[model samples]
Target: MKVSAKLFIVGSNSSSSTRNAVDMACSVLGVAQLDSVIIASPPIEDGVNLSLEHLQPYWEELENLVQSKKIVAIGTSDLDKTQLEQLYQWAQVKPNSNQVNLASCCVMPPDLTAFAKQFDIQLLTHNDPKELLSEASFQEALQESIPDIQAHEWVPLWLLRYSVIVKSRGIIKSKGYILQAKRRGS
Candidate 1:
């Protein structure tokens, strides 16, 4: 089975979290390596926009995994032409592909298309929401799922989605989501 995983970093998280998530996925999937791991990191809400600086740490971690043969390829989600160019130039391991949200822009920007073509990076389309899960929605679900838990105090750190595909037939065999959360204070 060919396994692919996408890690969604919802907020400010340590670079090491990427390593931890990959390790967990490998352990669970019982595979020493994954076919690909795509990162979907939301911009930090400090009023500043998403920049290469915000992505460097995460990319570095993924690059390390690639070097160690734990992950074959790495990609990004929701990055524009400018952001993608910055990362591609600065990164030691260039991104193999990028996912553009069709909902945001009905047509893929020509600049992005040209850049991807020039760099030989694959351009993929997706309709995923800007935010997969809002904090309030997450808390509500948690509270309902586990009646006694203090849902409000817990903050979701990251979510990993993995899928197993039948390579020969090009069919998905199984898939699941893994969410990691932490308490507000320690």
Candidate 2:
């Protein structure tokens, strides 16, 4: 039996905890790299919160991984027109795509659409919340399920996704999640 594979994971911990997530994902998936990882993050810079100054560090890190052949492509979630423009203009390795949550807005913003077309940056639509698997919710769920466990002592770091495929079929053979949990507060 022969199986080929591809996985694109949407995640909310890229800015705060990318390394941990990547490490865990690599271990669980038994693979060296992911085809794509669309990371969730909010703008956190002064003045123009969505400027290159805010996003450059994160994207550069991802870019380094790409240059080192760790990840094939890096994408961002929930960036609007001006933010994406800032990133595109300043990044050494331009993002392969940007993901917009349709739930937040019924349709893509016109400015974003136009910019994406001009720059050829793929715009993907997602239904997932901007903050997927928030720490408080994940902890609450775990506490309910396992009374012995101190859920608060463990932080929900991130998620890793993997897939197996049959090349001829062009369909996924299997897929799974590797969740990163970091222990804290003794």
Q: Give the number of the best model, judged by TM-score.
A: 1
lDDT of 2 by residue, 35-123 (tens): 67666654242464455555565667677767877777787878888888888888888877888888888878999999999988899
lDDT of 1 by residue, 1-186 (tens): 899998988756798888888999999889999899999865587677998988999999999999999999999998999999999999999999999888888888999999999999999987778788777888999999999999999888888899999999999998998888889988
Candidate 1 Cα lDDT to native: 0.89
**Highest lDDT model number:** 1
Report, for every candidate in turn, its global Cα lDDT versus the true structure: 0.89, 0.67
Q: Give the TM-score of candidate 2.
A: 0.78
Model 2 residue runs over 4 Å out of place are 1-16, 42-51, 161-168
Q: How many backbone clashes does candidate 2 have?
A: 0
> Could you tell me how far off, in angstroms, the CA of residue 79 lies in candidate 2 after the best superposition?
0.5
Clashing pairs in 2: none
* Alpha-carbon runs more than 4 Å astray in model 1: none
